[model samples]
Target: MEDDALILDLQPLPDGIDERLAAQLTFIAEADRLKTVLRASPLAAADRRENDAEHSWHLALMVVLLAEYADAPIDVGHAVKLVVVHDLVEVYAGDSPVYDPQAVLDQQAREEAAADRLFSLLPADQAREIRELWDEFEAGATPEARFGKGIDRLQPMLLNWLAGGGTWSMPGATEARVRAREAGVVAASAALGDAAGLMVDEGVRRGWIRTSEG
Candidate 1:
């Protein structure tokens, strides 16, 4: 028989405590690196480049504020989630300027590998959820994904316009190319697309972006 006065030496932790907590904490810590991943787009009034984390935050806010502009009914919460997690892989894959032709060549493969490594840092369920969100945004199949993609394209274009054609000054940045790339914005939101078109025309007039024939 066991002694009534016997005391337990060490207490056992609750079930799944260490494994779950460790995975979550590790993922959170890894996500912090996104703050250092600088993008090609500059801040509206500032000279410094924007980081991926800041870009994601801005997109999340845009999702909330601009959901009404989406062409179809959408789940705003789901859209916000998609934008916030969409660029986490950029932390590992690094940013390629929108007009960089060489960089765009293998961009998908590079980002896919980055997504695998970054999302796998989380617990299995969480990893699967985030990877799926990232995939949806890439596919742009759903109304929400299309809206998210439009917002993503519009933000940098707006920033370039506001910065007085910051990156648009690149030689490859032609009015035709800009319009071609931003067609998705029109597909998702006509009003926003029209606004974007005006900005591009203004950039061309200002000689910030070159004319197609130039």
Candidate 2:
């Protein structure tokens, strides 16, 4: 956690800033803290966990590269925007691990409050636009949002595979839990879903993930 002194003693914005620009800059400065919000997923090549900013950036890139795999036609630009802004609320709510049953109990309420507080830092128009995107992504009601959700679930699985089962090796990580968590990936894109299944199967075969019977 950042010390209160460092967070409270922020430098003031320079003089003569236009109202709109000041709001925009203020939101941007607040976004900087997202980099400090660490997630449970670790780097593929290292022991350290990936931060929320890195996770969001990687999701945006995934949308760019895998947009073609979406089950239905989608606006790639909108999908990219969805991924980029999806986790901004984590700056306030903090990243909750998917495997942590207790942490997920009130996840929606916590994130919604964070979204309201963080996005409200921007101009009204900008805040509404961002909040809509965030909500859409959360709802997963549209083709683009479904695709975005697919990659969001898929990325950590891929990372755990590449990192030699970093999280999968933890106690209580069973094949059933992994499959249940990633069912959305399969629903959105069969190809990517197959790939994710292959990773999990390999993980189990190699003893990276434990089976229920084990």
Error of 1 at 38 (Å): 1.1
lDDT by residue (tens digit), candidate 1, 14-133: 467688886777677667778989988889967798999999999989889999988899999999999998998877788877777887788899999989888887899999999999
TM-score to true structure, per model: 0.89, 0.93
Clashes of each: 0, 0
The TM-score between candidate 1 and the true structure equals 0.89
lDDT for residue 4 in candidate 2, whole number 0-100: 25
lDDT of each: 0.84, 0.87
- Local error of candidate 1 at 46, Å? 1.7
lDDT of 2 by residue, 94-190 (tens): 8888877787889999999989888998999999999999999999999999999999999999899889887786665788888886798998898
- On a 0 to 100 scale, what is the lDDT of residue 49 in model 2? 93
Clashing pairs in 2: none
